[model samples]
Target chain A: MIEVEGLTKFYGAFPAIQELSFNARPGEIVGFLGPNGAGKTTTMRILAGYMPPTSGTARVAGFDVVDQSLEVRRRVGYLPETVPLYPEMSVFEYLTFMGSLRRVPELEDRVDEVLEQVAMLERSESYIGNLSKGLRQRVGLAQALLHKPEVLILDEPTIGLDPAQIIEVRRIIQELGRERTVLLSTHILPEAQQICGRVLIINRGKIVAEDSPGNLQAQLAGAERLVVAAGASCEQLLQLLGGLPGISSVRAGSRDGEVEVATVPGKDLRPLLARTIVEAGVDLMELRTSGLSLEEIFLQLTREENDEQAGG
Target chain B: MRNVWIIASREFRQYFISPIAYALATMLYLILGGIFFINVYFGLETGQITPDGRIVIGAMVTILLFATPAITMRLLADEYRMGTMELLLTAPVRDWELVVGKWLGAFGFMSVVLAVTWVYPLILHRMTSPGIDQGTLVAAYVGLLLMVAAMLAIGVFISALFRSPVAAFFVSLGVMLALWIVGSLASSSGTMGQLAGYLSFVDHYYNNFYLGVLDLGDAVYFLSLTALALFLGAQVVEARRWR
Candidate 1:
């Protein structure tokens, strides 16, 4: 439903996004993960026809953002990072205004439908400025869904919500994913994993990694390690395990009240380490494999990027 | 055109719901009324105005200077300040539609305030039996509307340049003051003076409408100014999309 090719945005002498290119299929929820100032909002603005890219092109629903901006805008709903709203307008009033601007076929009905979808129907008569942050976010979501656009571009859709509100927002996003194309930008890793069908990890204005959560997790399989606990001094443990059979390498450390040894990636070292400990008259307390979580994988990838930059 | 009307109606409705619009209208009515009655009282005592067309036009022009900014300053600046411009710009509306709709919205709002000035003329009519010519009075109202429309376009154009409504108000005040002073000096200076007079919005308005003569040239001038400013506003918005 959306295609961005060689899209670049330059603000004066600085490049906000350089050659950003991505495609989002119909009914797909693609999470755009990046740190602050990482060009996420810039890309969303271009796609929504609010701003023109400095070079290249972006097309939504087969219409060019620059040349066919009206059609593109009609088909894409955008919720900017700041959630642009008229504070004096009541929730229903604001949505009604937005609906009229969008030329919705049945504006009043659409307003009610969207308000219900965002769980703001009860507070529809309340002014937006009087609402809490969570409720305001819901209203923003409702505005984006007003026209029933083919694609929705949300910048940080769930940034500051309380835990319960965050869950509600996530569920609403998930439901939205089932019907239309969703491209949400968030720095929160769990948000991407929970609500996104595919994830694009962006850093410094470039897409560094793009894959499903499972595929990215699978890539970390071989790097998983088993930390074995043994009764020995730190240096002595490192020396004993360095040349042990079936062991790649060993780095000694301490965990709790005992000395721990980190075995490098290889065959299961628990069985071998247990036998070795008995022969060496050392006590074995624990043998557990360390599973790589999504958070750890994200850190590992980003840290590798830092290492590459340092090397260059 | 449908999109333009939609935006225009919503903006027009906003002016009624917010207190700023009412406050501005009340303040303008009080100021215009104060100036009008004070002049009427003094004119009876000193015989300066004498219920003539000149004093009426002068009083209306003075009212325009103060009242124009109240409506026009918030036209674009308030949207930019509240960040709602992004939402409006991203809609399926055309640039010209947004500009014309906003100009009309603010114009309609100022008209409501200007409508309250009718009481002043009514008071003068009751006091002076067979007082003001209905033709001159009707023409004067038309002139005031056209002048306000033209001034509003300029103010709306300036409003687009800033994100603060106060800045827009002050900029509009400065621009209006320059035009008022420049036009007043034109009649004394010859050909160059005549050229300045042509550029002055009030000169043509007072000569044509206030004098009970509706000149097409003067009417076209105000219309042209309004169209030009609105067109420039649309172009400004379009250009910002690229930046």
Candidate 2:
């Protein structure tokens, strides 16, 4: 439902997002994972029709963001990083006002529907300034959902919330993803891993990697490590495991009766190692594969991009 | 047009819900009422009836010079400071809709101030024989409304330029004062002086409506100035997207 092609944006001489291209299909949650100042917000702003890209094109629901901004805006619901709201307005009043601005067909009914969806019906009469941060964020979400747009672009939706509130928002986003296209941006790696169906890792105005969280982790799980508890001395086991095919190195682990093994990239030495241990009459107590976490994968991707930029 | 009215009504409701609108209204009525009472008291003492409310109209023009900025300073500045401009600009509404809506909202408040001041003329009519010249009274009010509309437009434009309401308020006051005093600084004779006089807001008011003479030139002058200010304010709002 959203397509961005060679989208570059420059503020004065500095490029915020350069030659970035990505797409999010309907009923999919695409997490834009990036560190702070990694052009996440800039990319989302361009898609939301808040600003035109310096070059290239961004289309939402088949409408070009720059050429048909109003139509694009009508089809996309954006929650900015700041969750902008009028503090003086009541929750119901704010949503009604936003609904009217979005030209929603049944503004009052739509306001109530969104309010219920955000679980904020009880606090509809309360002033926005008097609400807690979590409640205000929900109100922000209600306003974004007021018109029931086809695409939802959220910038750091879970930022500045307590852990419980974060989980609640994640649940809402996961639920929302089942109905429409959601392009959520966040610096939090776990947020992407836990919720997004696909992840786009961006760094320094460029997308470094894009894949599912599991796929990203698996792709970066090169030189996989293994831990084994055996009925042999660490040195002897190391010697035996090191001699096996695909086993690059073996060393004594921190605990007694344990040996650590490292295999070459794309190599699975578990079955071979098990058979060798059994034929040698060595007891195998335990064997486990330790793959890279999404956090480590994210760090590696961004760090490698930074290093490549620095080297070039 | 519907979007414009939506934004306009929201801004208008905001003015009444906040204490600032009431405070401004109180200050305006006090100044206008105080000047009207003093003029009547002095007229009674001299045993001469001056039923022409032109002096009150003149004071109102000066009062609006200060009061309008207070009303308009928060139009766009508060939106920026509070971060609501993102919500506003990203909506399906056009830039001109937001600008014109806010300008009309502030103008609506100024209209209330003008409406309240009418009581002074009503009282003058009740107290004086051969009361007020209906034509002069109507003409004076038309002039005041036009001046207020022009000043509010200028205030809205200045407000759009700054993120801080205080800065917007002071800058608007400074600009209005400069425009008000430009005619006094002119020599009143040379071609350059004539240009300066024509540019001055004070000259337009005094030469036309303040003297109970309705001049179409002054009317067009204020309307065109208001339109120019509003157009510039809309441009500023649109430029923010590029920034």
Alpha carbon deviation, residue A179, candidate 2 (Å): 2.8
Interface RMSD of 2: 0.7
What candidate 1 gets wrong by more than 4 Å, as runs, is A220-222, A230-247, A254-286, A291-293, A296-312, B39-57, B188-191
Model 2 stretches astray by more than 4 angstroms: A229-233, A252-258, A264-286
Candidate 1 lDDT over A137-241, as tens digits, reads: 899999999988899999999977999999999998898889899999998988898889998877667787788877777667555466767666666666666
Could you give candidate 2's per-residue lDDT for residues A95-197 as a string of tens digits?
Answer: 9899888878988878888888888888999999999989989998888888888999999999888998899899999999998999999988888999999
Give per-residue CA lDDT, model 1, range B1-243, as digits (tens).
Answer: 987787778778988987878887776666666777788888878865455433445756776786677677887888888878888888888888988898888888777766776777777776775576778878878878888898999888888877898998898899888887778778777888988898887688767788888888888888998998898888887877777
Report the Cα lDDT for residue A258, model 2.
93
How far out, in Å, is residue A209 in model 1? 1.4
lDDT of 2 by residue, B80-174 (tens): 89988988888999998999999998888778768888888888888888888888888878888898899999999989999999999999999
Candidate 2 residue B132 Cα shift, in angstroms, is 1.1
i-RMS for every candidate (Å) is 1.0, 0.7
